[model samples]
Target: MLSSHCLNDDPWNKFPFTGFVAMISAVLTLMVDSITTSVFSRSGKEEPHADVASAYTPDQEMGRSHHGDHGLNLSDDKELGSTLQLLRYRVIAIVLELGIVVHSIVIGVSVGATNNTCTIKGLIAALCFHQMFEGMGLGGCILQAKYEWVKKAVMAFFFAVTTPFGVVLGMALSKTYKENSPDSLITVGLLNASSGGLLIYMSLVDLLAADFMGQKMQQSIKLQLKSYAAVLLGSGGMAVLAKWT
Candidate 1:
């Protein structure tokens, strides 16, 4: 994709391609996270458990409600906060999945549209390893979300199909689509840039921040260091793949 775009005589010179698409992606992710958080927050607060409510007498319930309005017990509050945090994490995982799907599709289409066998071989190798690691990360997030089996299957199916679907679309359009064309450059460049930004934001802010700052990591310095080292190694490996693809 970069090679194709470069053939168009530096599209970046005329357009602030990177910054524009990145800003759009950042805004999109922020909006999604904000809306999801607000909706979850309101839903979490408004629902009351009927079983728990039934356990209390009217007078005791009233007193307890009053106390809850003012303050909650430390342990209770901590438990409630943990539940809410998990809920938020599930939402973030969904959003992250969406960004990754978009990226996967774009890359798949680009790879499928190419005619060079040499390039195809290299891309196949790079993408195989790329998807393997990427899948592990995404699978971890989905597992953490604790989705039902059916929902998990559905998400997995969608993730699995996106690239193939893109490939199909690219093959269908291969006769007419010119990757180096001005139109293709603009469209593909923007899509790639936006997806890049979205993935970066989701990785750092949603995935990394939540785990690294969570209680388990915070309590263990050695674990934190090991995790950071793992992150760097994984990131560097992906960066190396970028050179080939």
Candidate 2:
């Protein structure tokens, strides 16, 4: 008969312990990404303008004034900045999806390796709910990125297939694979830790913080409170799932 011990050492058992270390790694990554993106974005703006201004001749300056070209240049700059910002958001969304996909595959493999009927049932349920919520969160970021349909399709396809692929892999190796082995524990644990950190960082810095600090949320206290409640609800649901699967 399959037992809890056979299912793999409950990594959840290490919660708040190993989780703390993961949080630190995640926070560091978030800060680094933020700082680097900010520095590059600022440099992109200033360097181009400086180069253009330095090369301007008296004739060019006169032509610019005659054509009301200063305003056009400012408009073009705004458009360029907006495009760059959108590209940044798209990249962040892709990275966030990668982290989610890694964790999903791990979870799927664990579930697939199980032979216990009852254990499988509960795991299937929990995984369904888990993926549903995760997809919603990831979908929001992708939507905001405003990707072309083909790219969106590619991202969505990978996210949808990862868990199933993992399940198939696990099933094929079920006889030989030992989920509770020390090697398995260390490998899964480290992957889980890193992926957990990445999700936390993305959720906080890229998703929640961006929306909360935006003009729309900042201007409306009622809306902000509602949004906070929604976040809490989603987080609480995931926390509860942590106890089971």
Residue-by-residue lDDT tens digits, candidate 1, 115-208: 8888788888888887787788789888876666777798899889998888898888888888677677768878888988888888888889
Q: Look at candidate 2 and tell me the lDDT of residue 236.
A: 88
Overall lDDT per candidate, in order of appearance: 0.77, 0.75
Each candidate structure's TM-score, on Cα atoms with residue i matched to residue i, is: 0.81, 0.77
What value of lDDT does candidate 2 attain over all alpha carbons?
A: 0.75
For model 2, state the Cα shift of residue 64 in Å.
17
- Candidate 1: worst 10 consecutive residues by lDDT? 48-57
Candidate 1 residue runs with Cα over 4 Å from true position = 1-11, 14-16, 48-79
